[model samples]
Target: MTSTGSTIEPPTTRAMVGASVDQPDAGIARRRWMSVLKHAGLIALSVVMVYPLIWLVVSSFKPNEKIFSDLSIFTGDLTFENYLHGWTSQQLPFSVFLVNSSILVLGAIVGNLISCSLAAYAFARLRFWGRNAFFAIMLGTIMLPFHVVLVPQFVIFRELGWLETFLPLIVPKFLAADAFFIFLMVQFIRGLPKEIFEAARIDGAGQFRIYSQITLPLMVPALATTAIFTFIWTWGDFFGPLIYLRTRENFPVSIALKGFVDAQSSSDYGAMFAMSVVSLIPLFLAFLIGQRYLIKGFATTGIK
Candidate 1:
C-alpha cells in the first residue's frame, strides 16, 4: 500500500548511514595502526641507545678474562673485586680526585651563571653606545677553536703564576670565556616578552634590580642548563687537568683515571670500566636533578 517514492527512500537512507559508519571506523583503524608503528620505532631506538650503557655496566662486573668473551649484559656473573681494586690501587687517592673535580665543577658553574647571565642581559636589554659592536665581536669569538688558544692561554696562566693551580681551570669562566652559553642565554632572554621589562622599568625598578628580582626568577631553567653543561664539561676535562695539574695530589678523577692505562702491560679493562661507571654517577645525578628546570626553561623561554 506504500507509495513507490516512499519505498525507495528507506533503502537509500540505510545505505548512506552504513557508508558513513564504515568510513569513520576504517579511518580510525588506519590512524591507530600508524600510531602503533610510530611507537614501536621509538621503542627500538631507545633500546639501541641504552644497550651500550648496559653492556658497559655488565662488563665492569665481569672478570677480566670473561669481559670480552661474553657480550651479553645479563649472562655475565657480577663481581665487586674490580671496583675494590680500582679504588685501592691508585697513586692519587680517588677520594681526593673526587673532591678536586667537585671543586672545579662547582666553581665553574658559579662563575658561568653569574658572568654569562650578566653579559646576556646586557646584550639582550641594554642601549649602550657600542652594544651591537661588542655583541658582534662576542659572536666572532665563537669561531675560534679551543686548541688554537690553548698555548696562548697556557703562557698567560704561566706568566700570572696560575699554572699548576685550579686557577687555570676556573678563572676563564669568570671572564665570560664561554661564548656559546652567553649566546644561549641571550637568545632565551630575547624570546621573552619585552613588556615585562618595560613594566618593571615603569615601576621604578633599576636594571640591576630587574635582573636580580625579575629576570633571575624567570631564568631558572636557563641557569640550570648552563650549570649542568658547566659541571659536566669541568668534570670530564682531561687535557686541561693534564696540562695544569703536575702533582698527583692535585689530579681530578679524569686525570687519575688515565693512570689505569699501562704503557707496557695489558690494561685492566674490568677496573677501568668500573671506574668509568663510578665517574658517571655524579654527573648522572646532576642531570636528573636539573632536568626539570631544563624542560621548564625550554618550554617558557621559547628558545629553539
Candidate 2:
C-alpha cells in the first residue's frame, strides 16, 4: 500500500501486464508471415503443376510447325484453325466420338447410381445369411487389380457377343461391378441414422419403398459423387474402347484422340492438343457442378 492507502502495482506486475498486452500483437505478426509463406508456396506449386497444361493450350493455338520449335507459350501466332481442322480430320466428324462418349458416360452413371446404391443399401441395412462374408468378399475385390480380370472379362463379353458395343464398357456398371463405388456408398448408407429406418418400418414402409424413397433422396451427395466419378472414368477410358471398338464410327473420344497419330502418315499434334483441350471441358464442368456434393460425400463416407 502507498502512504495514502492507495495500492500500487510493483514493477514486475507492470512488466507482466505490458507483456500480456503485447503478446497478441507479436502472435498476429507471426501468423501473418506464416500465411504469406504458405500462400507463396502454394502459388509456386500451382504454377509448376499447371505449366504443362498452359503449354498444351498455347501449342494448340500455335502453328503445328511452331510447337516444338518454340517452347515459349506466349510468343506464338495464335489461330483457331487447329480446332477447326481437328473436328473434321477423322473419317467421322469429332462430334460422333463426342456423342459416343456421352452415351457411354451417361449409361455408366445411371447404371452405377442404381446398382451401386441398391447393393450398398442391402449391405448397410439388411440382414441375411452370409451377409458379412459377402461384404468382405466385395471389399476384397477393390484390392484386386482390374488387369487381373481384364482377360476374363473380355472373354465373357466376347462370348456374350457384346464386343464393339457400349455394353462392354457400361453394362458392368449396372451389375455393381465397381467395388470401390459400392464400398463408398455402403459407408455412406451406414452413416445414416438407424432411427430413420426404424421410423420408416413403423410407418409400414416396405424395404423397396424405404430404399427408393427414403434412402435415395438422402443419398444425393453419395450419388452425385458416384455419377461424377463414373463420368470421368468412363469418358477417359482408352484401353476398354481400344480393345472392343473396331469400327471408326464406334470409337469414343478416347479412342478417336489416338487416331491423330498414324505411323503411315505424319502426326497431327496440333489437332490432338486442340481436341484434348476440348475433351477436358466436360470433366471440368462436371467437377464444378458437383464439387459441393463431392466434398460432402467424401466427408460423410469413410473415403478421404
What shift in Å separates residue 266 of candidate 2 from its native position after superposition? 1.6
Candidate 1: regions farther than 4 A off = 1-34, 262-266, 293-304
The runs of at least 3 residues in candidate 2 whose Cα sits more than 4 Å from the true structure, single-residue gaps closed, are 1-28, 262-265, 299-304
**lDDT tens readout by residue for model 1, 1-304:** 5443324444555556435543556555766898999999999999999999888888888888888877788773789988887675676557888999999998899889999999999999888999989999888887776898898989999999987799988888998998777887888788889999999999999999999998888877688888887887889999999999978888899988888774216568888888888888887887798877656655654432
The weakest ten consecutive residues by lDDT in model 2 span: 1-10
CA RMSD of all predictions: 7.8, 7.2
Cα-based lDDT for every prediction? 0.83, 0.86
Best by lDDT: 2
**Per-residue error at 181 for model 1, in Å?**
1.7
List model 2 lDDT by residue over 232-303, tens digit each: 889998898999998998999988888776522756778888998888889889889988877776676554
Clash pairs, model 1 backbone: none
